[model samples]
Target: MATNNIKLISPDSKLLQYTQIELKDPTDAYLESCFAAIQQNRYTIESNTLVQIGQTNKKS
Candidate 1:
């Protein structure tokens, strides 16, 4: 496995980002679990298609 440091630049701004530290072998079940976790949890809609993590609602 490898680690990658990412940077984002916007007009007048710069930010640092970190990718996941662990990489798993790909599989359908793994994908399903990930999607399921996301779908079942609460999320706050930041926009039409964007959401902030850790902002999930308890009612979900």
Candidate 2:
């Protein structure tokens, strides 16, 4: 069996997510992509949240 590496690209072509799928069977992968697209914005928001948390911890 072969595998395909796919990256969920953002509107600006940034990499929002990544996954490996079986080349011969990608149905589940497609469904996952749909969910990923909906949650893509969360990725950036989460990243910012982490940075803010880190800074707050450092100050405490």
Candidate 3:
């Protein structure tokens, strides 16, 4: 079987709220549940500042 890595990030209360939510057990009991859970998390990336910086700055 092939495996891939993934990452998740969040702040405190949001993290705690996320932790409290329950997931249904997989019928196949696949080990991929870990990856699925991580993929299911909600995230917000701050793209505004990053877009401005990249546009305003140029590399030499």
Best by TM-score: 1
> Tens digit of lDDT per residue, candidate 3, span 1-60?
212222224443333222222334563234344334434542232442211112245689
Show where candidate 2 strays beyond 4 Å. Answer: 1-24, 41-60
Cα RMSD, model 1: 10.4
Ranking by lDDT: 2, 1, 3
**Once model 3 is optimally superposed onto the true structure by TM-score, how far is the C-alpha of residue 47 displaced, in angstroms?**
27
lDDT of each: 0.44, 0.45, 0.33
lDDT of 1 by residue, 1-60 (tens): 232323445556643333333445565445444444445554333444434467545885
Candidate 3 or 1, higher lDDT: 1
RMSD of 3: 12.0
Off by over 4 Å in 3: 4-30, 42-60
| Estimated TM-score for each candidate | 0.28, 0.26, 0.22
Regions of model 1 farther than 4 Å from truth: 1-26, 42-52, 55-60
